[model samples]
Target: MAREKRTEQLFVTVPSFFRCPISMDVMKSPVSLCTGVTYDRSSIEKWLALGHNTCPATMQTLPSTNTTPNLTLRRLIHLWISQADITPAISKQEAADVINGEFDSNSLTKMIGFINSSEENLKFVALSNHAVPKLVEAFAKSDSMRVLELIVEVLDLISMENAVREKLNELILKSDGITDYLSSFNLVLQKGNTESKVKSARILELMAVNSDSQRKIAEKAGLLHELYSLCSVETETSAVEAGLSALLAISTSRSVKKELIRFGMVKTVGKILSGYDYSSAVRAVIEKSLKMLEMVATCTEGRGAISEDRECVVEIVKRLMKCSRAATEHGITVLWSVCCLARDGTAQENVAKVNGFTRVLLVMQSDCSSNTRLMCGELVKVLREKNMKSNLAPYETKTTHITPY
Candidate 1:
C-alpha cells in the first residue's frame, strides 16, 4: 500500500503494464509467475528466493515457481524509449537560426529534440551551425526549470565538439553569453531539485575542462561555494559525486585553487570522507575528492588551508591503505605538496606528527604503480632532510652562548 502511494506521488500516469507488480518501477526485464501477474525479473527472483509462492498483485497462490520472460513488454519499453521525443521537428535553417541567436520558441524546442535524437547527421549539422552561444542564450532566457535543464542537456552534448569548446573558451574569457548561462546555472543550484542540480553540475564539470571556463568559474567563486554546500547537504550520492566532480574540474586551473582553499574545501571533503561507509555508491566520491585535493594542494594557499586542518591530513594518510592506486597516488601527492611548498611550518610538522612518514615508506615498498613509488620516495627524502636539519639545529649553536638549564 505504501509503495503504491509513493509510486503515485512520483509519477502521474505510469502505464499499469509498464510497471512491475512487485517493485513498481518501469520493468527492465519483466517476467511472469504462474499466477499470471508480471514483475521485474530480479524482483520476482528475490520473491521466490524468500519462499514466497503467492502472487504479490493478485494475492493468489502459485502452483509453480517457474518464471517466463515477458518479451512483448520488453520490446514495447524499448520502442517507447527510442521514440520518447514528442517534440516536433524543425528545418535545418530554423535550427541554424536558433544557433545564430534568433530565439524562436518552437525552433528552440525542435533543436532540443534534434540534439536528443542522437543521430550523427543531426549532431554534425548542429555543430556545423555553431550551437554553443545560442544554447547559452536560450538557457539564460529560460524561466522554467524544466527548460533550463533541457538547455543544459543540449549544452552538455555540444560541448564535446572542439570548435564548440573553443568558442565557449572565447566567450568565457569575455564574460559574454557564457556568463549569463553560468548565472542561470547558479540559480539552478540554489532552487532546482536534486535531478536538475545534478545535471547542472555535470554540465559545469564538462565546461571546467577548458582553461577559460575554469578561470571564468573561479571568477564566480560563489558558485563553487554553493557546490561545496550541496556536497554537504545532499543525501543522494550521485548529486554529491557530481558536485565533487565539478569542483575537481574547476580546481584544474591554476587560478582556481585559491578560491577552493578560501572555501575550506579540504575540511569539507574530510568531513564527507570520515562518515562514508564503504559502498559502491560512495567509492566514486572518495576517489574524486582525493584527486581534487591533490590538484588544490599544488598551490601554496591550498596547502595552507589543508594544513590548518590536522584531521584533513590524517584522513588523507588513512587513504594510503585503500586498494585504489589512484586514491593512494593522489593522497601522497597532496602530502608531498604540503611538505614541499607550504612556507608555513605546520604542514611538515603535521606530517611527522601524524606518523604519515611510515605509511609513505610502507607504500613505497609495495607493488604499487611506478608513480606512487616515485612520489613516496620523494616524500621520504624530504622528511629525512627536514629531520636532519632539525636535529643539527641545536649542534650549530655556539658552545660559548649555551646556558645551563
Candidate 2:
C-alpha cells in the first residue's frame, strides 16, 4: 500500500522543467528564449505580447524576443505523458459543464489542448457538442483578460467551421452585444499584448460583414486610431497585415475613409511603402497597403494626400509592374485616381520624372485587364501632353509604338 501511494504521488507531481513558469501547466509546445530558459509557446507568446522584454523565469533582460522551439523538451514531455498513462481528452458533457461552470484555467487549458489535438474525431466531437454557444456565453460574461484570451483563441479555432462562424456572428451582432464587447475589445487593444490585440482585431474583422456593423466598428471610440497605429512599419508583419485587413473591411463607408485620413492613414501607408524593403517584406502586406492606398485615393482627401506627398506618388509609380499582378493593378489605380481623375499636375510630373511612360507602355503590351489597359492609355496621354516640349526620346516613345487602345 505504501509503494502504491508513492507511485500515485509520482504521477501527480510534474517535474519543474516540464511546466511553463507563467501558467504552471505542462508545456504543450515548449520553446526557449535567448536566455536559454524554456517555456510553453502560448505562455511565452502571451508574456512577450504584453510587451515584456525580459525572460519571465529568470527576469533577465532579453537581447531578442524570438523564441526557438525546444523540440527535445517537447519530445520528452510527450514521452512522459505516454508513460504516465495521462489522457488529455474530455467527454462532450464534461466540456459543456466546464465551459458553463465557473472559469477554471486548468479545464480551459484542457479544452484548448483537446481542440488543438491531432485527433480528428476529438475535434469533431468538441464542436458537435454545443461548444460554440457555451464558449460564447463564457466570452460574454468573463471580464478576466486571461480568460478572454483563452476563450478568443478557442473561438478563433472553432470559427474555421462555416456554421460556427455564422453562429458567432449572430451572437456578436445581437442587440447590445456589439456595444458590450466593443468596450472589452477596446480594452484589449489598449492594454492587452500583441497576440491578444491581433486576435481581437481578427474577430472584429469577421464580425464586420455588413455596412451597419462596419460603420459601428469604425465609429467605436479610438478603435480606428488603434488600428491605424498597428500599420506602422516597425510593427510585426502579421499585426500590420491584420490592421490593414480590418481597416479594409470597414473602409467601404465614405465617413470611415475620411476618418482614416484624418487619423493620418495616408502618411502612415506612405511611410510603410517608402521605408519597407519589398524583397524582405511580405507580399500580402504590400498588396494590402497598396489596396488601402487605392481605396483612400477614391475620396477627395485621399487623392490630395497622395498627390501632395511627392515621395508617396513616386513610390506608387515605382511599384508599377514590379510586384504581383494585383499590386500592379492597385498601384495603377492610385496613379489614375490622382493623375487622371483628380488631375493633380504635381502627380503628373512625378509620374513623368520616374520614366512612368515607358512602364505604362510595357504594362499595356502585357496581358493586363481591360480596365487597367484603359488607365494606362490615359496615363500615357497625360504624360505625353504634360511633357510635349521636353525631349520625348528619354521616355522611349520613338522605339515602342504607343498603342491607342
RMSD in angstroms, all models? 14.2, 11.4
Candidate 1 residue 148 Cα shift, in angstroms, is 1.5
Return the top candidate by TM-score: 2
- Please give, for residues 1-405, the per-residue lDDT of candidate 1 as tens digits: 453343223333446678664444457688888766788876678677888776654434578888999899889976765555333445667666666765443444556555534445346644674566666666778887656755655665466456776666666546656667678888889887776687678767766766756767767737877787678789776677788888877766666677667767788888877877644335567777788788887777777788888888878876775525556778888887877656346766666655566667776866678877887887877766666655533112233321111
2-51: candidate 2 lDDT, tens digit per residue: 53344334323778689665444468899999878898887688679889
Q: How far is 154's C-alpha from truth in model 1 (Å)? A: 2.1
> lDDT (CA) for every model shown?
0.67, 0.74
Model 1 lDDT, residue 64, Cα: 86
**Model 2 misplaced regions, further than 4 Å:** 1-93, 119-130, 389-393, 397-405
How well does candidate 1 score on lDDT at residue 368? 72
- The candidate maximizing lDDT is 2
